[model samples]
Target: MDHIRRLLGRVTAAALTLLGVSVLIFAALRAMPGSYTELVLGPLATPEQKASAAASFGLDRPVAEQYGHWLRNTVTGDFGTSLVTRSPVASEFADRLPVTVTLTVLALALTLLIGVPLGVYTATRAGGGRGGAAGRLLSAFGMSLPEFVLGSLVVFLFTRYRLGLSVGTYTPWSEGPLASAGSLFLPACVLAVFCTAATARTTRDAVLGVLVEPHIAAAVARGEPKGFIVRHHVLRNASVPVLTLVATLSAYLLGGAVIVERLFDVPGLGSYLVDGLDRRDYAVVQAGVLLAATVFITANLLVDLLSGLLDPRLATAAKGAA
Candidate 1:
C-alpha cells in the first residue's frame, strides 16, 4: 500500500511538473518579439494578409484559448505542424529523437567506462603518489575544458594530422551498428569529457569515504580478499552517491547534446531544436522543450526508484512518509 501510494505521489508530481513546464514554454515563446506570421509573410505583406495568416494559424485567438487548444492537441499526441516546414512536429521529433538518444547513451557509456575505473584506482591510491597526482591533474584538466573548445580541438587535430577519422559526418544505423558508433564516437567523447571528470571526482570521494568506514576495516582485519572487500563492501556502499551523480549528469547530457550535435552535424533533436529556434518555429521548440523536460523528469523518477531499491533505508523512509 505504501509503495502504491508513493508511486501515485511521484506520478502526480511528475504530471504537475510537466504541466508547469508546458505553461512556461508556451508563455516564453509567445512573449518573444515578432510573430511567425510576420516571418513567413515578410514586411512587404499588407495588414490584411497578416491578419489572414494570423487567423489561419490561430494566433488571432486569445492567449488562454491558444494555450488550451495546444494543450488539448498535445494531450492527444498531436504536437501540431511546424510553422516553417509545414511538417508534423511529432513526426519530426520521431525522426530525430533516436539520434539524440544514441549519442547520449554512447556518451554515458564512455563516461562510466572511463570514470568509474579511474575513480577506483585513484581512491585506492589516495595517499600521496604519482598515480593519484596524475589522476587528479587529469580530472582537473577535463573539468576545466569547455565542450566547444575540446570539440574544436579534436576537429582541428584530426584535420591537421590527416587522421582519416570521420569528424562531422553522421552514419545511420541502417548502414550498420559499428558504422553508426564510429561516426558518433568523436562527438560522444567530446560530450563525455566534463562528465567523466566530474564522475571520477565524485566516485573518488564516495569510495574514499566508504573505505574508511568501520565495516571496511573489519573486513580487512578478517583477512577478506582485497577484490572481494572492494567489490562487496567498498563499491556497493559507494554506489548510492555515485548513482545520484550519474543520474544528474545524465540529465545534463540532454542539454549539452544540443551544442555537441551542432558541432558534429548530427541529425538529432538538439539540432532540430536549434533550427526551430533559429526560425522561431513555436511548435517545434515547444515540442522539443516539453520532450526534454519529460525525459529529464522520467530519468530522475527512475533514479529515485532505483536508489530506493539499492538502499532499503530509503524505501523504509519513503514508506514511513507515505
Candidate 2:
C-alpha cells in the first residue's frame, strides 16, 4: 500500500510538472516580441491580410482563452497543425522522437559501460597511486571539453583518417539497422563523453564513501575476496547515488541532443524544434517542448521508484509516514 501511494504521488507530481511546462511554453511564445502573423504572411502583407491570418490562427482570442483551448485539445490528444508545414504536430513528433530517443539511449549505454568500470577502478586505487591519478586526469579532461568541440573533433578525426565512418548524415532504420546505428554512433560518442566523465566522478565518490564504512572493513578482515566484497557490498550500497546522478544526467543528454543533432544533420526532435523556432511555428515548438518535458519527468519518476526499491529504508520511511 505504501508503494502504491508513493507511485500515485509521483505520477501526480509528474502530471502537474507537465501542466506547468505547457503553460510556461505557451506564455513564453506569446510573450516574445513581434507576431507569428508577420512571419507567416511576410512583412509586405496588408493589414487586412495580417488580421485574417491572426484570426485564422486563433491569435485574436484572449490569451487565457487560447491557453485553455490548447490545454483542452492537448488533453484530448490533439496537438494542432503546424503553421508552416500544415502537418499534425503529433505526426511530426512521432517521426522525429525515435531518433532523439535512440541517440540518448545509445549515449547512456556507452556512459554506463565505460564510466562505471573506470569509477570502480579509480575508487579501488584511490590512495595516491598512478592509476588513480590517471583516471582522475582523464575524467577531468572529458568533463572540460564542450559537446560541440568534442563533436567537431570526432568528425574531423574520423574524416581526416578516412576511418570508413559516415559523418553528418542520418541513416533511417528502413535502410538497415546496422547503417542507422553506424550513423548515430559518432554523435552518441560525442554526447556520452561529458556524461561519462560526470558519471565516473559520481561513481568514484559514492564508492569511496562506501569503502570506509565499518562493514566494508569487517568484510575485508573476514578474508573475503576483494572482487566479491566490492561487488556484493560496495556497489550495492553505492548504486543509489549513482542512479540519482544518472537520472539527472538523462535530462542533460536530451537537451544536448539538440545541438548534436543539428551539428550532425540528424532529423531528430531537436532539429525539428529548431526549425519550428526559426519559422515561428508555435504548434511544433510547443508540442516538441512538452513532449521532451514529459519524457524527462517520466524518466525521473521511474528512477525515483527504482531508487526506493534499491534502498529499503526509503520504503520503510514511506510506510511509517503512511
Candidate 3:
C-alpha cells in the first residue's frame, strides 16, 4: 500500500508538471516574434490569405481554446500534422524514436560495462587494496573531457587510422547486426565517456564510505579476504549511489545523444529535433520536447522506486517525511 501510494503521488506530480510544460511551451511559442503566416506563406502573401490561414489553423482563437485544442489533439495522438512535412506528427515520431532509443540504450550499456567495473576497482584500491595511482589517473582523465571533444577525438582517431570503426554509414540492425554495431560504436563511446566519469566518481565515494564502517572494519579484522569484502560488503552498500548515478546518467545519455547523433549523421530524433528547430516546425518541436520530458520523468520515477527497494531505510524515511 505504501509503495502504491508513492507511485500514485509521483504519477500525479508528473502529470501536473507535464501540463504546466505544455501550457508554457504553447504560450512561449505564440509569443515568438514571427507569425505562422510569414513562415508558411511568404512575404507577398495577401492580408486576406494571412487571415484565412490563421483562422484555418485556429490560431485566431483565444489562447486557452488553442491550448485546449492542442491538448485534445495530443491526447488523440494527432499532433496536428507538421507544417513543414505535412506528415502526421505521430508518424514522424514513430520513424525517429527507435533510432534515438537504440543510441540511448547502446550508450548506456557501454557506460555501465566500462564504468561500473572501473569504479569498483578504484573503490577497492581506495579501500587500501592492491591497485595503484594508474586507475585514479584514468578516472580523472575520463572525467575531465567533454562529450563534444570526445566525439571529435573519436572521429579523428577513426579517420586517421582509416579504422573500420569509422562511421562511414549507418545500417539498421534489422539489416545486419555487425554492420549496425560497427556504425554505432564511435557515437556510443563518445556518450559513454561522460557517463563513465560520473559513475566512477560516485562509485568510488560510496565504496570508500562503506569501507570505513565499523562492521566493515570488523570483517577485515576477522580475516575476511579482500575479494570477499569487495563482493559482499563494499558492493552492497555502494550500490545506492551507483544506481543513482547510472539512472541519472541514463537520462543524460538520452538527451545528450543529439550531439553524437548529429556528428555521426544518425537519423534519430535528436537529428530530427535539430531539423525541426531550423525549419520552425512547431509540431515537431513540441512533440520532441514532450517525448524527452516523458523519458526524463520516467527515468526519475524508476530511480526513486528502485532506491526505495534497494534501501528500505530510505523508503521508511520518505514515508515518514510524507
Model 2 gets an lDDT of 0.86
Regions of model 3 farther than 4 Å from truth: 40-46, 127-132
- Tell me the number of clashing residue pairs for each predicted model: 0, 0, 0
Candidate 1, residue 267: Cα displacement in angstroms equals 1.4
Question: For each candidate, what is the lDDT?
Answer: 0.86, 0.86, 0.78
Question: What tens-digit string does per-residue lDDT give for candidate 1 at 68-95?
Answer: 9999999999999998888999888877
TM-scores of all candidate predictions against the true structure: 0.94, 0.95, 0.90
Model 2 backbone overlap count? 0
Cα lDDT tens digits, model 3, 1-322, are 9778888999999898888888887777777777677877888999999999888767788989888988888978788777778788899888777677777788788877877788778877763545735667777888888777877777778778876665647888788867777778778877888787788778778878888899899999999998998898778767887887776666666654788887788887877877776666777777777767777778777878887777788899999998
Q: What's the CA error at residue 117 for candidate 2, in Å?
A: 0.8
Clashing pairs in 2: none
**Over 4 Å off, model 1:** none
